[model samples]
Target: MLDIAKLAGKIPGISHHFQQEMTASSQRLELAKTILQQAQNQQEALIERYQTWRDRLIFSAAMPVEPLDTRITIVPPPHRHSVFATDGSQIAPSHHEIAYCYLINVGRVMLHYGQNLHPLLDSLPEVYYRPEDLYVSRQWGIRTEEWLGYRRSVLEAQCLADMACGWVNPPGAHHEPNLAMVDGSLVYWFLDGLAHDARDLILVPIQEAWEQLKAARIPLMGYLSASRSVEGVNFLRLHNCTFDTPNCIMNCVDVEEQQIPCKVIEPLRDTTLWGENLQPGQRGPLWQSSARILELYDEAQRIYFCYVNVGTEIARIEVPGWVAEDQDLFNQGLGIMLAQVNKGFGYPVALAESHNQAVIRGGDRIRFFALLEQQMIRAGLQNVGTSYKEARKRGSIA
Candidate 1:
């Protein structure tokens, strides 16, 4: 149990600290906005400088695909369109349980508006108990949870691709403007930490799914709400630097004062900077990511992102290079996304429904362990039991 009285006594101090932080944040935001406006005024010079200093940049910034200040209004979606989404939930392998296994449940949803209003909702559950399935590389000290997460992401992408392909190449020959969406980033930056073989094991399947979607001409996007991404802000820092030739490693430290000039606007995020400029239902300029992992991805599957105002908050929408390069597909994809958010009231309806389908509640987890123990006992394994710590958690004594 929590000590409410003790926590309440610290509230005043916490509030004071929060107020001080907010004041500093506001001042930094103003400075960042001023720099943004200046960049807009001298866009050409900054672009040229970025081209010259691209190789020396140490920060993970975004490469601009359009004018820095460009804002495109999201047009209304077509009367008859479909949105397909997939989300996943997992039960991580627990040592306290009777079995050393994990389960992944992927929820798939397809919502149709206008002419056809049929909505499809389903989930696919898979259990991994084999030693080979549970480990990426035990010698490399990789955790099973990390491997599970990557596997789940790959499954979600493949599921979305299969659904989109079915919609595009329907047996009945019915087609409509459709958009495919996933919950998070399309870029697998986390894979950079893994060994080469393990990373390739995950990337190959994801790339194949992307290829399937591209071949089917289906537009796909990943939506992130309340994004705190700093890609654009870091780009601004490069522009704000005072050095004739930027070298963050050696030259910045060699300065007598040891103070980096571009660090002034380092506290800002892309969402905060764009929120002040973009109106409701408008999207800021698209920017390609400079993540190192993209070098391994196919050229067509490289990720690009844009900040969009979905009325409630600024969201980051990510798409593959192919979708971003096609004007009609890009417009259609954004339109469908906006319409979905309006229907769900600030969230995408298909994603929300898919989450509902995928969620595994506490009661479900308890029952799953119970069933596993029962099956084990029925199979002549009478020693099946939970760990002492798990048993103690279930029954506490005063």
Candidate 2:
């Protein structure tokens, strides 16, 4: 076997790598500082340009400016509430494995805070081996990793939504705000590249999930930590000098002296701006996602997001436009999310717990294959041999 001691000796190299990244991050901070300074007093101008050139702007750009204070203290959690979080994991089909199949495992955690703090955990696994379930993209002639990813996304949403739909009041008539959270963007970020029909395969289920949650009177949110999206920066970019010119390239290239408008705010992600401004329990103003896929969704399901300072990191939290438009639901959702963050030490405990439950470990995979092999032997069927490379790895002495 390889010497783990030798691997431990590489700690210095890892530390060096960490230092290198921190140095680059410091450089980025200087650039971001310059951008924030240049954005001063220009919010209204940027908002105007956004209204005029929104459709013409890049799909990845931000919408109109929603003015918000740079910093605010964390809001205290509601005394009584229930928070539900779900996360899913998958074992992609492998040709070398005996079974031509895949599995998606979803984990859920429900946390209650009030008279007593407690948590309930559950995990569900679904296996797919049927030809139709194993492969997608019939029109395109082959199932790709992209299709599999999309399937997993749909399953994840469905699992959480189903759970939310079944939630009920606590014992003895105690009532509390109920909220559900998922671990990604509310928008299907990959749909921009898909045809309408193909996109619908994934979008329909997600829309149904939203409707189910809404009908159950539960607010659903998608939470993302370490977000680097440029929604805020792109909004400022709309205020570029080329926005109104007939022949302008929208890149400020035609200016006589190369006087690039919005130069200071160029290439910075919205997280940096929010990170500099928001305090724990505080969030940036909500803005609609500018992703091209939003056009495919109805207004009720269109995605909206805001950046929340979770004490440890600036996280982007997304919800449907309908949720954002509801003043009461929106505030309650925010409160529950922040409360979970506080309880989890800068992250949502329920999501973290669910992820832990859903992960498939190496030993588990080995046991799964062993079980499959045993079943084949009992049925008097020849076992599908593993690839030569895999066999060698299993039999090798060193």
Candidate 3:
């Protein structure tokens, strides 16, 4: 004992290091507990349940679980300082007799401040839904062909991504996008791509690009512009705030009235994300959704409603507007065989769905246009033609 004591006295640094270790251990334990609790608070059990089903069942609906959603309007950046905007579009999709062109417009805005770059909206692709060659589906049920339609949508969206990236840094450009804020999530944000082919999911390329961005420490973000899409029709799976009605009712934990603060972040560092409720997708851990809304104006006028079979999972289904013979809202009692068309580098969600699932059996363009005219009148707008025409440049107005 005497010899041990004498030896210990000689090693003063070891004693100090031991004391520091004990202190660190105590502090780390507390931190670990708090972190675990916070994670639990945000844990999504519904997502887990869905995952479990995916693993256990062989005959499940295998519905695409696109966790990312477009539930709100993107609040455009306040300034555009030398930013490069990017967009995408589908040239055309075959349908009935008329040609349907789908456009996805991308805009990227970058500002250089010293060595650091400030991105306004980097590769923010907004969908300008339209048609290429479409025919009425009332002759046949579109529901049966939903999977094929959805697959096409996924591919089209990916094409849009490619188009958007084409502008990120031109072949010989010296500069990179200061920030990249896409209109949709990293990729296939609205696509349940895994349902079709996991490797083919648009997420593959999107993920690769995103990783490159992260490694380069380039700030990249995505904005969910609208609350209703093919996948978003079913909004019950979300763990965060959701609006049953796309208008004035915001279903948030704290704020319950109107307006969901909005943010289109290029996550250089932690920041805010606000908009409508987002749907789910393949990018789980890396992608995050922050609570932010732009303003509380004009929410009462918007409404989104879609129907799906709650009992079973299924591949994505799209009831293209051109395929439906529903009464056109632009005119009354007239059948609307209308299809949205857009310029190259535009959005073609062409996967447009109606809220009420209006029957198109006896629908016509004249009556359908009439209803659309009424809707336009109620909204105090003269014509969507001008708006749509103006959108031809931006690729979208939604």
> Each candidate's TM vs. the true structure?
0.95, 0.85, 0.27
For model 2, state the Cα shift of residue 387 in Å.
Answer: 2.7
Deviating ranges (above 4 Å) for candidate 1: 254-258
Off by over 4 Å in 3: 1-177, 187-201, 211-216, 225-398
lDDT of each: 0.87, 0.74, 0.29
Q: Which 10 consecutive positions of candidate 3 have the poorest summed lDDT?
A: 332-341
Q: Write the per-residue lDDT of candidate 2 for residues 262-339, one digit (tens) a residue.
A: 444445577876788776678877777777768888878888888888888989989887788887788788888888
Q: Model 1: per-residue lDDT, tens digit, 239-268?
A: 678878876766676654436788786677
Best by TM-score: 1
TM-score of 1: 0.95
Q: Which prediction has the highest lDDT against the true structure?
A: 1
